[model samples]
Target: MMLENSKYLFDRAQKFIPGGVNSPARAFKSVGGTPVFFDKAKGSILTDVDGKDYIDYVGSWGPMILGHAYEPVIKAVQETAAHSTSFGAPTEIEVEMAELVKRMVPGVDKIRMVNSGTEACMSAIRVARGYTGRDKIIKFEGNYHGHGDSFLIKAGSGALTLGSPSSPGVTKGTAKDTLVADYNDLHSVKELLNTHKDEVAAIIVEPVAGNMGCIPPAPGFLNGLRDLCDAHDTVLIFDEVMTGFRVAKGGAQERYGVTTDLVTYGKIIGAGLPVGAFGGKKAVMDVVSPVGPVYQAGTLSGNPLAMAAGFALLSELQDKPVHYDQLEEKTTYLFNGLKKVFDKWDVPVHINRVGSMISVFFTDEEVVNYQTANTTDKELFRDFFHEMLQRGIYLPPSPFESWFLANSLTQDMIDKTVAAADKSIEAALESSKVDSK
Candidate 1:
């Protein structure tokens, strides 16, 4: 209820950091409030600098699946730091992490480590183009693949949060090459492929789109993309930066039963650290760097600390695979509860969920793509955001972002969140009416 300290911190941060946050969305500009500066997070709870506690649903934007400050990840990082940090040379842990990732993620036989999802995605597109001898790539409008120049066209996440899906500074040439498609719509993709034909190199997608509020592919949509890619010789790349490891050990590829030629991973891979990777069949990956002419390298690509943290997290996930099951149960429970709350208030809302990723739009229209998602009432979302924050429930500050659930969220936490939702929904409904007047 008290945000005096958080307000002071934000004021100070604004002096140096742009918008009082390193990330655009963290500024809470969309939600209309001073962003809470978290002092610490343990398990599923976050304690703000103002000493207010909240059940965290953002999960550090999808990397804290096993929960914040997970012991194994911490110990691994500390142990690795004891020996050394970055060697600028080969390490066994890198090989082990790659192997573990390949084993956990189906269809990946080789991999390249990178510092962030943007790097991995940008590198993946390069490799795809090099291997296929093509120039164009297709990506869904609302499915974010990071800040790569090619991916900035109609990108989501922070881009959407700041009301600039098409950022400035991206060259016209880069934008021209990156073809935009609609999520869950096979016809849009088909039209592009039909026109471009052999010129398109890869069709990248988030199989379970999280950037535009956790919208899952409509039935047979993924299969349609795979088939189209196969027929046209376009590489099917799954940008699983958010869904990888969190949705399942094998990720959306396994969950949806559709395999891709190359898969990019981040988020849970580093257990909240700065790490990302891309991999697939050896024949395709062989085109990268030392194997062939397609060059992609990172100085901190496989830094010891990130590799150790990733390895520790992946190892635990492999051993205890049911973490996803628990996550799904919790998410489903929360989803149903929120739906009930919305129904009680008679609020016009739509929620999309899969596994632990979920989102609620303040619109009655079904959120199938970027166009429909934009139809949501942003003003209503701002009110609901503040209402929930007042009651100690921290959600994604933007409506278009997914609510990432951590495995550490207990039944009691879910209950408390549902109770908060009931009040928040009522308040949002009243606020929307006021705004309309």
Candidate 2:
């Protein structure tokens, strides 16, 4: 648990990188510590610079579904790299990747690749606006669709963790067009649609919310959105960046039996590489540049390395669809084990899980949405996080983020995690009591 090396690296990183981390979540600011600098990771274990090993659950923020350095994906990247990297033009692998996506995903007739989830979402919003000829887009509170200017208002994930749901750089004009709604509350969406009427372009949501800690959509919540969008002629967008490929073969849309007008993907789609995509019905996607006039382009959009890696990972997932079931079973085992530990320790906690995405909120209240998710005692979670880290279990630094379990995690790892939780919960509770005294 000694983070001396990590501390040194953090200090060095701070001299160059903002907050000593490229991503705010990596700073461990909310959890109160210097972030661990990993030397390498393989399977479910992350080896830090100091050579300490911990069972990993963050999974590089949801991309390492098959686990870090998965052989097939790595091999694909290596082979593709031997040929070349970015062409800035077109490659056959890109077409193969797109075709594979269309085959696996439910409603993706056509797709456009992007460098990141943020780009995918931002581009999707533009397509929505161009197709509908409307300005406003409705996004649920705590449903982070990346750092796009339009998506910053009431955003979650890093924004929520950093206590700035709306960043300052986002102009008022952009904010005005992005309406925020309460997740799991259909009435809030109805109110926005009623007020905005035909002016709204799209309604975007994380089908199974991962940013606000894996809050599954309430019963009929997604279907409700679908119905409302159908009635209002507004595009329905599912920001499946975290859940795609990991939750199921086709993602939340397949798992829930709900089709969306557009779907944005990241994480598992790239198989730990930096890649993203937005796809939907042919008609809606046809509006994007060269086809109709929504201009969105990326120099490295379909970099050969990314396409090969993504295709390799996805092909495996497609071939062995049972991996999804295995992942869910493992997650359920871990969840139940953790629950038993909390119960045994008399620790008040609420757990929310869907497929392999899960969260442990240090509160008794059910975490159905961002507001309820925020009710969890941050101090308690901070204590729990450190305690678990000390015991060789690495959880997401912030409670607002979901813990993505990888297929690489074995029963032994789950058992160890549960055992760690047992001790960590007691230690955390003891620390809270000591602080109160």
Error of 1 at 307 (Å): 1.0
* Whole-model Cα lDDT of every candidate shown, in order: 0.90, 0.93
Q: For candidate 2, lDDT tens digit of each residue in 301-331?
A: 9989889999999999999998998998999
lDDT of 1 by residue, 301-339 (tens): 988898899899889989998888888889999999999
What candidate 2 gets wrong by more than 4 Å, as runs, is none
Query: Could you give the C-alpha RMSD of every candidate to the true structure, in order shown?
Result: 1.2, 0.8
lDDT of 1 at 55: 94
Best by TM-score: 2
Once all C-alphas are superposed, what RMSD does model 2 give against the true structure? 0.8
Clashing pairs in 1: none
- Candidate no. 1 TM-score: 0.98
